[model samples]
Target: MGGPEQQVFHPNANIVRKAHCSSMEQYRQMHARSLERPDEFWGEIAEQFHWEAPVKSNFFSYNFDINKGPISIKWMEEASTNICFNLLDVNIQKGLGDKVAFYWEGNDPEDYTRVTYKKLLEHVCKFANVLKSHGVEKGDRVAIYMPMVLELVVTMLACSRIGAVHSIVFGGFSADSLAERMHDCRAKILVTADGVWRGDKLLHLKEICDTALDKCSKIGHNVEKCIVVSHLTRLSNAHTQKTPGMKPPVHKTPFTPGRDLWWDDEMKGASNFCYPTWVDAEDPLFMLYTSGSTGKPKGVLHTTAGYLLYAATTFKYVFDYHPGDTYWCTADIGWITGHTYVVYGPLANGATSVMFEGTPFYPHNGRYWEVIEKYKINLFYTAPTAIRALMKFGDEPVKKFNMSSLRVLGSVGEPINPEAWLWYYRLVGQNKCSIVDTFWQTETGGHVLTPLPGCTPMKPGSATFPFFGVQPELLDENGKIIRGPGEGYLVFSKPWPGMMRTLFGNHDRFETTYFKKFPGYYCTGDGARRDEEGYLWVTGRMDDMLNVSGHLLSTAEVESALVEHPDVAEAAVVSHPHAVKGECLYCFITPNEGVHFSTTLVAELRKKVREKIGPFASPEVVQHAPGLPKTRSGKIMRRVLRKVALNDRDVGDTSTLADEGIVEALFSNRPPEASKLLKAC
Candidate 1:
């Protein structure tokens, strides 16, 4: 129930006066100017930042032709800059040394930590010195696998300070997943921790790192050193620990003496004065891997200067952040949201951000609201998945806290349904703060389609407008542009400063996947509709992928895992509606000619999927099918399968089906026991 008619929250007087644009008319004018004369518009904004060397030109070549080789998009290619210096040192030079940089909160309420700009710089310098002592030089890839702790931020900054590209893997990922990333990046050093507390249990992070290192070494990965941080000082020494229903390693895992070093030991005598490295603007700052349709993840590489400038500018305007205002974005550091908004974006703007170490529902459903009240957080940003998950517990948990301190609320990661957006506006915002439903991805380093909190109008389900420098286009399947008020595949017409330069080690795949689809435009892989007023409503992905609770999962990856079992002959995986998670996987498998299908086989298949990928990818439903609808060339018709999984009676045209009887067979002979199996599990 959100549209142009919804009540709007105007920016504060001070905020409006200092913003890039004050009103709707000014926003439209500035947006047009950014597109018409981007060089002049962006060059002025870039001057606000501290560049090591002046930029000669904003663009290398302005050509978006698909037939003319590759898109030659380059910005500030010859300039030199350092993101760490712009984030910390520049702020300190402006007499902001005593301002709070990060307000860290632990799982338990009693545990807390605060670091000012001066202290954060000191920590980063010391860690940079430690990394240098361990032979980590420029251009080396450093893998960071740690929980949401202060050390995580310090390590990332230290890596950037030394010109080393950091690749951060999710802490919950399995050992195989970690090894795959490490092997792909050829990481020279690995950083981890002993253990971390989640809810009432301890996750043995060091154990996972050790197991992943073993796999990495076996795969010819030459990691020179592993730096282990002691999160929990006194973990049990026993190799195995068994709880009632879960099996978690209770002990602190051991490390190799010559190749491993403790965090404290490395930082003991290190000097706290290391100069930030001067890297070319095009030098890679970090490599973040996103799930791929072909089962192997692709590392999306972002550069130093362009990504930082984009992130900082967007953070300043979108959130309308003021000095001394606390910002909290409840996202993991491993994801792009955290990398941009939580760390780089906020720090580059010199705004105080909150780092939370626990889940939203761990201690209670009210944990987020409590933090907002506890720290006087003004801007709150989080994924729509968390908002929907918390909606199930009703408004009682949210009512216990005073939410008047919140001036802006944001939804990211996935499209927010109308119901969830309404609940967030009414309950969490208390009708005082504005809600911005931002639509972007891991490839775009910053927000692409979002309403600037104070400048743009509020719309519940729609991502109102594109960011200033972004040019969005809607195109039909035949490569024809749909100008106004139409639904089509979403594409960006021009390259922006924040867009990913290339995929690590796979430039061909990057071009083939994104540009090859639409030829002249960057295909976003998602369908969308533009209203008469030019607001964008993003429908889910149009490809063979699923956005399960904001995490991208490939249907092909899940199908490949399912068919790996000996009992399965072929498999087709589809997605269906979910209440909390945006979507859940539903697998249809055809067993071998004489193989018996039973719950035992289902359990085995699930285990294989969990081992191959991560447990988050295990299908919610596994149903046996005698035959699947396919075309003449033997391609499984996923559209037909998706309709069947959703229990829709209107099955589309069967004229292209090789076997028309297969659809009837699949629907009539569907296993009744499948529902029971899903419920019991």
Candidate 2:
């Protein structure tokens, strides 16, 4: 399916006039310079941060061609720096210590906290000392499994301060998922919370930690220490009335005599000052595990200096951030987006960020807008899934709030559909704010293809162009580059500073997965097409492309068409094994609130897809779903949908799902008509 070929919305004149790169010509010139003179462009940007010893000779070197040498990429090889120091100390030294670092919005609407740069440094130092007292030295792995609390951010920075590589597992992950990650990383210590309130439910995190540790011990991978933060107790102390749908917070959690320690007790005796551990630029900063095609998760590792520079640079330009802009990225710290935007990138730039600890639907549908208005948030970044979900509630919830403070809006996690983009632009932004459709992945530390808010004109469903130094090209199946206006696999022709160093402990897998595909290009595993305007459109994952009776179709294109039907809130398109047509589309759709799913609705959805993507792309089975299974990060679990469509007994891992019950619900809620159609598969 083809993407939008022409610009739909021009950048807001007011924003463009005040932007860092005020004109398209200026942006083009800077982008050209970034590609032509890579070392000079990046070296100048790197100088903005503090480095112990700057690179004297080669700033960067890489060999994507595995045949020429072992696949390698190194940046600022001779430099040494501390990410924690640059993010905190540098900003403090610049007299920004009294500025709010993070505005924490807790699950309860009344519960909130403002942490300043100096206060954050004190917390980080205290936590670093706590880790040190527990024998967590440099190079040791620390697994952090906690909710979206202020302490979570502090723990990450603390790990960086002590030169410990942190692997943050999402709090919603099951004990098995936690155990697997801890085992893979061979973590020496695990930091957790007693319990956390998500909406109304209180998740006993310390109990989950205990179970994970037991599983790890059984597997001969023992985590020596577990530090527990009493988040629930703190919440209880803050509010006299208990939150609805949640039981009163427990006074204390079950603890082990030798291994378990309390966060409050440790901080009582811990010093508020600790020295930053200087690490090589090439040293790993964090390893975030992402789901792989093989059912196992891949630990995507990002280095210090390069990742910091790229994240900070992208944050400044993509969001058009100012010194006092109140930025908020609604993502959990476990994900790469939160690492780059919510904590590291914003802090490194000395920007105030919002760290929310709840869902969009909780308390009310207007919760997100309420937070925005309450904080007067200037730059708002969130996933398209959230946008679509909120769209189901209609515009009243959003229209009631004052979003006048919003200057720039951002879409992440997935490619946004035209309908959702228009809604976000018209309703939430009031047609004044610029929308930055960011496209990147866990492997890429920062944005790859995106529109600079104030520079590039917005296209409803397009990523627009590549970020600085990101040379993206479309490559055909035969390994030949598709120069212009063609559809093929998306790959980067050259390496950027933010690219992942390697899959942790799996250099061969990294080489084969990214480099072996096209020989000399870093494979993005995504399919895309370039419009006549040279704007790139990421269709979906390459595997999501289906060949229906020799007709190639992208699932994203089909889903977008289905969602345009007005009655549908969200749709996930997957393929089931077919006998006649090589493969047929199996669609699971969640109807909008107050809209009932009926035979008429199903037929209309199929006709919508046919009209948009041709008859071959029409879904054979349209299953009515109450909800689509999604990870806590709001990414739909398409793999689970594919397996369920095939009626496969082995549905793989459900541990990472935000709501495991949704899987069973999808199976049981399959309409009879859908079952009849699915039989042909």
Candidate 3:
């Protein structure tokens, strides 16, 4: 796909760890053992961690049908253990306290913090004690909305120590978005900072959280407190409070009677020796909400045992992690990749990693290369989007680094295009590293499908195959699995540990959304095909989504904001690929009668959407029209719009359109002036 449109041989191919799995002996061994002896393998993993009490069944059989079917796919069925005990306390007790656990870097150039395993234990224990003093107890849901910082990690572990479920919302989400998650879980305590500094901008995070709370009515009765941490202190509201550092016997307010204290102050009451709350292997540990375009986001709940097992397993084998390897996953903590790899997976393996808070292009184009050289990193994991972005800058920036320490390279978030893969392989890896193109999702928990380092044959643009315990299937619309080599819907045939338990509070929705779509299987909402050699090629989403430059952005979410404007009454969105990005947005705006179009107006509209949503949701083009193609139920016919965006005349079935005349009008009156502006929705 790059240069000659043919794959070229890399000199480092033979040196790759694939020699250890040339025959796929390791893959076959793990796959056969994990599948045939699922219980024994998982049970063994559970025993590795300290437990408060032993459980009856190491795993509860995954049952789709059960009256009390909420995360029933549990592990260590009857066991009780605190996660903090395994993540922090035990490591310290083993004399690993002095070893660096996390090296945190903030967007601010001067912001850098290093935390050792022992100090992490103390912070987590101290914070756990603070939560208890503020009436936070077992079974409570705490919402953590903050920028990528040391406090975020400490908060999650602290909650784990106290047996409380933590729902971490990425800091950039709008207030309405924040409220949706908070209300869904009925979070008793909201932990947020005054503001967050991203590059040069200081966003008022707490103010946004406050505005979001105004729209939430579900947690009115249960919500008890708001714990605010000072970031850009000036951006805070009246509720914001500042403390020099976390200490005991801290001041408290009577607002919640038992709550309303600084994040640092709340931790002093926590005893460093306080034991982590005991948990069943199947207990719901954390709830992460995905960005849903069609409806309310689903709260993908993950249990402790099964999740820990999969996360630990993937981290160990995927990157071929070793004690001295310095790993770095360049993704925000908001996505599943960050939660599992950046936090849980790497730490569980006792491997040191870098937590980056800034963007790839931030400060300079050489930031990532500089970080690797500075830290002596061996494993570099990032998305294809990032690779391509850096590719545009050419190789001049990378020439400054001495990157010989690099060993393994990985790609996640989406399938890496063949062109990007090869570019990353040569430009970044310098023909000296094995590239693992990973493919999975928020629901898959850890890496479900991939050619792990030291395993499987190299395939450009292919995800390779399913990992251990994964039974990959290419299903048709009727839910029939296509065999051998073919294209169809991508689905998982069996239940895995990291699969989401439910759709937050809506059980029926979960069943209808995932189960009903494909009987007896998990619908991945993706389209994939296997090659003759058994390698899988991912086409794109079966659903409506424009993966603009590899960042999954929804047309509906964009159009909804466009319609919010008084001039625009309706809109249809689609994509058209460019040479750089895999795709670009195509927006067809049906403005109100008498409203004319102009390049200035279209540019303003795009800016408006950016203000409403974030910069990532901005539209590339906006075309004003009289009407949009839609169904009788008021659903936009995206298939036709996609064709129109690509400048094609022919399209598929249109009898379903609510207004067939609109399509004709869109084509007949294709405004010459509008095309000149070429604003894409």
Runs with alpha carbons beyond 4 Å of true place in candidate 2: 1-7, 241-248, 673-681
* Model 3 TM-score relative to the real fold: 0.76
Q: Write candidate 1's Cα lDDT for 8-30 as tens digits.
A: 34545544565555688888888
- Arranged by lDDT with the best first, the candidates are 2, 1, 3
Q: Which stretches of candidate 3 lie over 4 Å from their true place?
A: 1-23, 55-60, 64-72, 217-222, 233-260, 268-270, 544-681
Taking the tens digit of each residue's C-alpha lDDT, what string does model 3 give over 1-681?
122113434325544433334447667887888778877766777667787787664454775443335323555567777666787776667677788888876664456678988888888878777778768888889998887777888888889888899998877766777887888898888888766666565566767766766666544634567787765543232123334443323222223334445665566455776676887766778989974646568898887867877888788777878776889998777778888988888877777888887766668888888888978889999976566546556678887887788877899865565656776777778777877778888877888778766556666667788887888889876878798988778887677776777766777777776666776677788788787768886765667666666666555446545655556545666776654566766678766556776777688788867876677667766766676674432335567876766556787546435456777777765555435434432
Model 3 CA lDDT for position 325? 80
- lDDT winner among the candidates? 2
By TM-score, rank the candidates, best first.
2, 1, 3
- RMSD in Å for model 2: 2.0
Q: Which candidate do you rate higher for lDDT, 1 or 3?
A: 1
C-alpha lDDT of residue 501 in model 2: 93
Quote the lDDT for 220 in model 1: 91
Tell me the tens digit of each residue's lDDT in model 2 across 1-681: 444434478888899888987777888888899999999999999989999988989999999998898988899999999999999999999999999998999887888889999999999999999999989988889999999999899999999999999999999888988998999988999999998877777688999999999999999899999999988887776564544555554566899989998889999999999999999999999999988788788989999989988989999999999998999999998899988999888988999999999999889999999999999999999999999999999999998899999999999998899889999999999999999999999999999999987788888989999999999989989999898798999999888898899998898889988999899999999999898788898999999999999988888988888898888999999987777898988899999988989989988998888888898887888998899999877999888887777666578778767788999988887667556656765
Report model 2's TM-score to 2 decimal places. Answer: 0.97
